[model samples]
Target: MTSAAENILERPETARRTRLQELWLLFKENRLAILGLVIFVLFFSTAVVGVILTSGEDPVFDPALIRLQEKLLPPLARPNLETLAQGEAPRLGVYLFGTDDL
Candidate 1:
């Protein structure tokens, strides 16, 4: 029931698919493209985790929670009085990688 134009359009479909496959193989061989993909995956994972932790009323990671005294302490340092008084103590009890500047 199809016309001549439809027949012509259908004929090259396989050739087009083959060409796309060849193009993809060629693209994968490029080192720069591979590096870009790795960087993309690294940042993409962190972004997803950040979104999940920072969502809703009680965030898993609160960006505004700052204890000035705890800022420079090394990882696993005990919670001193200044940081304790802030009442926003890190739930883990020790900073995994320590706190950075607010």
Candidate 2:
């Protein structure tokens, strides 16, 4: 019977590698894997950039500020001045995903 550390001491053919080193070695070995990793990073970065670009002081990006709105109207197909006059106007004057009644 032997401890795990003793087993490692007995093995001479294998080398110890940190997780990142092991992952890098595997990644380097596969071209498709590298491409997939690149694609995933690009997509994640784009989403982060999109959120940063679209966010404003209005708290639309801030989940803490979000609250229930009064009206539950279907989103307007296009910018309608009449909608503005009829009810609460959105920041962009159009409800991209419907807006508050106020």
Candidate 3:
């Protein structure tokens, strides 16, 4: 029994290599899956690197020093304070996404 076990352990590594080669062949045959995998890896790397490089910065602290008056103003939309005061038709721009109304 020990000799049989030793023989099994001493067998050639072809089975493992064959499986790896088969996997490689399959991966090569699936071009779309390979492209998707590459894209996913790239995006993941970019996100990881971006986070690592930007982690030291304080998000709350605006480096541009925007005034409080400018805070919460909607992007691409002008303030409608005057319209609100007059109760008239408010002129608003198309905010692609909802802006932080200051």
Best by TM-score: 1
| Poorest lDDT segment (10 consecutive residues) of candidate 2 | 61-70
Candidate 2 C-alpha lDDT tens digits along 77-98: 3444553444334455555665
> Judged by lDDT relative to the true structure, which candidate is superior, 2 or 3?
2
Candidate 1 has what TM-score? 0.63
For residue 23, model 3's alpha carbon misses the true position, in angstroms, by 0.7
Residue pairs with clashing backbones, model 2: none
Q: Which residue pairs clash within candidate 1?
A: none
lDDT tens readout by residue for model 3, 1-102: 999999999988665557888898999999998999999999999888667643655432223332343346554655445433442222333332323533
* Cα-based RMSD of candidate 1: 6.1
User: Model 1, range 13-49, lDDT digits (tens) per residue?
Assistant: 5544578888889989999998998999999999998
Report, for every candidate in turn, its global Cα lDDT versus the true structure.
0.78, 0.63, 0.57
- Cα TM-score per model: 0.63, 0.41, 0.39
Higher-TM-score candidate among 2 and 3?
2
Best by lDDT: 1
Candidate ranking under lDDT, highest first, comes to: 1, 2, 3
Superposed on all Cα atoms, the candidates' RMSDs to the truth, in angstroms, are 6.1, 9.7, 11.0
